[model samples]
Target: MQQSSGWRGSADIWLQAAYENLIESGVDAVRIQPLAKQLKLSRTSFYWFFKDREELLSALLAQWREKNTGNLVKQAERYGESIIESVLNVFDCWLDQDLFDTHFEFAVRSWALQSNDVKAQISEADEIRLAALRSMFLRFGFEGEAADVRARTVYLTQIGYISMKSREDLAIRMKRIPEYVRIFTGKSPEQRDLLRFYARHNYTQEPYEK
Candidate 1:
């Protein structure tokens, strides 16, 4: 019953569909048959691209590592004249979906809870990302325990957002960016930087007054 002439789904297509399914329904629901049906293709196409379900899952994990971890490292390396600038730079990750895949982060962390291998990888990811943030703090004159604490404040807040499945509006989250910056850096974000943030986002609604 397999069509030898019709177009077949590419590897990227299968992976993307699988990734979305993982985000929406967790890893267990990412089956070849279901995805083939979703993609409107025969299930055999999956085998043409991925050797097996385990290989597809591994590919998903690799994608997550390349995207989430890679971006964190890149953000931490972006030049900042002062700590505030650097903090804002990192803030972009949360604001821009392309830079930070929080949903994917949530999915992977959920997957980690089920698999020991995944849990270890998640732990290593946490350390790598945490260390990246910690270095940012250290570079800005924060030293010793102080740097580590501030970095944790910043990194942990983001983790908490993912863990709690936060659904706050963009403008609302934007409004609190300053306070977050202040808490993490112990230095208030300059008015200009805040303005830049608003301008970059083109937000009409203001963050609620504290």
Candidate 2:
């Protein structure tokens, strides 16, 4: 059991190293020898935790789903009654300019094309996240096709912004997100402005409500 625990820890270290490297340099930059070197472990250590590079990639996809996709869905469900707040919260989570980089987006897109397994994983993760967002929109009074389209619009807008990777460009694009949301829910400009400010600044400060 102790040996199993040690192997699990090693696997986690490798996954973290791989994720960081992918975020920095793109998925093509990830390889087992380099990862082993980064972790200061023998290549044999990788075999203890994974069967091969494919297995490691699979694990990486699973981790991404758990942290990035799954957690955001959970957060949306928690705040589902307030559609604007829930959507903004998900955006705020993604606005970590340092961690969520273009390379990370590149990795996901590239892998989806190269690996059928990865494509399936990405599809499943997206469905779960989008369903959560759609449910939130429905709760806030959007109906059937309207809720679905709004949810997809918000989701795709976020992916498009991240793919662009320029803070200035994202800022310009983000300014219009509130208007889009309002179109779906009939929120007034003042209400949309409050949500927009909160999403951008990641704050719920008293000044925003006024």
lDDT of 2 by residue, 1-210 (tens): 012445334667777888888777767767999988777778887777788887777777777766677666766776534666666566654665342434565578667787787788778877987898788888888898988988888777777766675455445545655665566455633566465555566555442231
Best by the lDDT measure: 1
The superposed Cα distance between candidate 1 and the true structure at residue 16, in angstroms, equals 1.0
Alpha carbon lDDT of each predicted model: 0.85, 0.68
Provide the global lDDT of candidate 2 against the true structure: 0.68
RMSD of 2: 4.2
Candidate 1: the clashing residue pairs are: none
Q: Write the per-residue lDDT of candidate 1 for residues 1-210, one digit (tens) a residue.
A: 122334577888888999999999999988899999999998887787788899899999999999888898789878988988888888888877788899999999999888999999999998998899889888988887998888788888899999999899876788788888888888888777777767777776643343
Q: Which ten residues in a row have the lowest lDDT in candidate 2?
A: 1-10
